[model samples]
Target: MVISLFFILPIVSIIREIGYLITSKIFGAKKSKITIGSGPKLFHLSVFEVRKYYFAYSWCSYDSLRNESKLAHIIIYASPILSNLLIALLINGLLAYELLGLPNFWNKFVFYSFYFVLFDALPIYYPDGQPSNGRVIYNLLRYGRKSDFERNDPQIDIKKTDEK
Candidate 1:
């Protein structure tokens, strides 16, 4: 159980990316790349880059950021947590079935899945003081438009980022 739990952590990042991909596709955005972890490439599973570091971080990029609605972007950002939460709920339900009662491993997996998703989706800052994904969305909701977002977001300068 412990060994599997250790293995599960790394895969969680992949699961989040899968969620992102699905949501992006549904919203008609083209995904350009997906990178899991943060180091030299261990290998390639198709387009996915499996890095030396695992379970630390993951990112998915879309080909074009232009012409996307605010709501669409919000859905793309929130998809990971939403999908993970769905999976956790599904597993929890399965575990509850009387004839198919699984062991503690499944229960623990569901718990960790919920924990990771909530951790990312919450607005709380990390140790490095970066805003969570949910916080980013909150900021976007507050700003309402790209022009406003660029004006307010310190990380994004409109003059520098403006494609026009």
Candidate 2:
């Protein structure tokens, strides 16, 4: 449980956030960042930040995209879910073939990876009004843009800074 909670969970969270970072970069986001965990900052380097409670939560933020289009937004929103799913599938396939060692560890990792994917793919708004990736994707397809609440939600949209 300890290994699953701290080691496997945080690694899976980072992988999920990397999905967002990579897709946002592909879409030409001028600035992008991945914040892992919550609470006070532990350290940050380049586009990644690790907080004190390093497995509690994680998120990705980016400035405006150069190719700002509905399709791009939809894909970006779906990236994390896709990434987690892909990892889970790949791991499961390997396990099925008995191609990887440390079966127990791999099983735990696969479980957490799917757990993240399942929750992230659910189309629901969080308590703080932040929409899940699935919710954002649904809105993008149904309305051609983020909903009014998402537009104003600080958690969803990173405020632009004047710093160079």
Candidate 3:
């Protein structure tokens, strides 16, 4: 319990700091740059990682709301740190519940492990209403948008990629 906090705290801090920098230096002077007068979004991005494939960025504004429905090449990239934090906290919660002190800790371990795995299986862009199959497969599995069947299990080996 005590030791776990030690690890998670620093990571949280570092991730936040990095997020600030990236959103500033990288995201640059854009239309959807955080908030100024009105304040942040209602259910907007807190943190996301997008498995490293969500670097492309594009923004879209809505007619009804003041906020723009901005979607990145990868939705997960919207808030990487927050995503990591959620995963970490879930892990800690599982640990505290299942392994604070128990003899047969494996039962809890296996059970909690699925939470991690299944959450991961949410498919990078496969959240709820994803428009395209941009790594995250939650597109077709949603309600509003139709799915784009564009997936390719590219054939490449370690030695081949390393040459570049």
Clashes of each: 0, 0, 11
Q: Tens-digit lDDT track for model 2 on 21-134?
A: 999999999878888887788999999988889888887887678998888888888899999899999999999999999999999999999888888888887776667778
Candidate 3 residue lDDT tens string, 1-164: 33223433334334433443354434342432221112122334533222121212212211122322234312333334344445556656766577445523433433433443344344453333232222333442343233332211111121111000
Root-mean-square deviation of Cα positions for candidate 2 versus the true structure, in angstroms: 4.9
Residue by residue across 43-140, what tens digits does model 1's lDDT show? 87765877777555666766765447788878877888887788888888888884345557677778778887888788655554555668667766
Best by TM-score: 2
Lowest-sum lDDT 10-residue window in model 1: 146-155
Q: What TM-score, to 2 decimals, does candidate 1 have? A: 0.76
Regarding TM-score, does 1 or 2 come out ahead? 2
Better of 2 and 3 by TM-score: 2
Q: What local lDDT score does residue 46 receive in model 1, on the 0 to 100 scale?
A: 62
